[model samples]
Target: MAGDRVRERRTVETMIGMYCRGNHGTSAGLCAECAELRDYAFSRIETCPRRDGRVRCTGCGVHCYNPVMRGRIIAVMRYSGPRMVLHPIMAARHFLP
Candidate 1:
């Protein structure tokens, strides 16, 4: 369970980091908006009823996020997805962590 939480946290952190870097041109840390999203995501993950890291949010097909947050995360993923290739280690770590 602790391992799952770490994995979930790592994955969300990586995604948000990528999104913030790609969109805001900052490699330092998350912006205010992305930070909020990160916090929200972590809260959702920590309280997740499923508790299975193997089944990701998309694969689980569970609409856990609120409508607004869902849309925001989707947009972030869409914007940051293609750019993720450049960060191979981070991308791979997200899956392997």
Candidate 2:
């Protein structure tokens, strides 16, 4: 499970990297959406009940790296059971290359 989570994180990170490169590579390490997500995630971390201080996907047990930034992600996956499973599709729409 941990391995899978790591893989998912890496995949999302890679996608964010590609999105940033395609749009605004010279500005910062992350794009606007990714940054927003990061900020959102950070803001919610203290309040969230997850052990690692992250919002996890109920369906997959995948932790959200930027939970606070994307409300839609949380909303869509709120029914995924124990895991939080923010939609990769949504993240892709806003941040994927």
Candidate 3:
């Protein structure tokens, strides 16, 4: 179970990172994507940090590139397996209009 949890965490971190990067387009490091999502998710909540090496978007409840928060976010998101597979659509629904 612990191994599965670790794997699940990695998977969620990757997926959240990808979503922030906007469907795997040509982007640089997670920082760029983190910045973009920070701007996008800020409206829903204040103080979305892109500089602290971690950014959490309350709108979608996904943590972007923040090692500290990644595991927790993944644990929650993992419950929604289909949603993880359909992350782009799901993220859009939550973070977008």
Candidate 4:
């Protein structure tokens, strides 16, 4: 469970970081848009019912995120997914699964 939470955080950070870097040209952290999404994602992760040993969000098909936030996160993942190969460790830790 602890590891899953860590994995979830790493996944959100990596995706948000990548999205912000490409879309906002920032590398130090997320931009305003991505930051908001990141905060929402972190909150969801913290309260995730499946944290004990769970299916990944993308595959789980759970509607954990609200519609608007879900759309935002999907966009972030789309833009950042291809770029994940660059951050192999973080990608392997959570993003891949």
Candidate 5:
């Protein structure tokens, strides 16, 4: 539901923020590249047909993103996924079973 959508949005935002800060030296807001990715991610999340709370985008059947965007997001997640522990709540939500 709505809570799931909000949680997903927050999770992506946190991951993108961590990636932007660490990789792009952005302290307060996203860089232009990160901002574009963030916007694309948010839009995709909003339009995703599979709204199942248990089904993460990584595991979903849908291939909603274009190739370039998919590659970009994959990189972001790969970089930020392990670093999520810095954010305790998001880390738990993301890494816990």
Candidate 6:
């Protein structure tokens, strides 16, 4: 479970990094907005009610994020999800059951 959370966090960070780099034109690290979103995502993961970290957020019954953040993350996911092929290992680990 703990390992799962770490991977989940890494996946989120990777997606956000890709989004920030491509959209925000950050060459090195996350931009401020993406950084805040990353932190919020990490906090949400740490405090997730499903401590085992078994379920994908999309499949979960809980909608933990507020509307604005939810929309932002949905955008990030949409953009990065297809491009995840650029990061094959993370994509495989993320999608593998």
Best by lDDT: 6
Assess candidate 2 and give its TM-score to the true structure.
Answer: 0.36
- lDDT per model vs. reference: 0.77, 0.44, 0.43, 0.80, 0.87, 0.88
Clashing pairs in 3: none
Per-residue lDDT, model 6, residue 63, is 88
In model 6, the runs with Cα more than 4 Å from the true position are none
TM-score of each: 0.80, 0.36, 0.30, 0.85, 0.90, 0.92
* 1-97: candidate 6 lDDT, tens digit per residue: 8888898889999999999999999998899999999999899888889766679665577889889999999999999998987787997897787
Tens digit per residue, CA lDDT, model 1, 14-40: 778887887888879899988999899
Candidate 2 displacement at residue 3 in angstroms: 0.1
**After superposition, which runs of candidate 2 have C-alpha atoms over 4 Å from their true positions?**
31-33, 38-97
As for candidate 6, its clashing pairs are none
Of the candidates shown, which would achieve the greatest TM-score relative to the real structure?
6
lDDT at residue 27 of model 6 (Cα atoms): 98
User: Of the candidates numbered 1 and 2, which has the greater TM-score value?
Assistant: 1
Instruction: Tell me how candidate 5 scores on lDDT.
Output: 0.87
Model 3, 1-94: lDDT tens digits are 3333333334444555655455455365556544454333333233334323233342334454366445534443444444555666545533
Backbone clash numbers for all candidates listed: 0, 12, 0, 0, 0, 0
Q: Which wins on lDDT, candidate 2 or candidate 5? A: 5
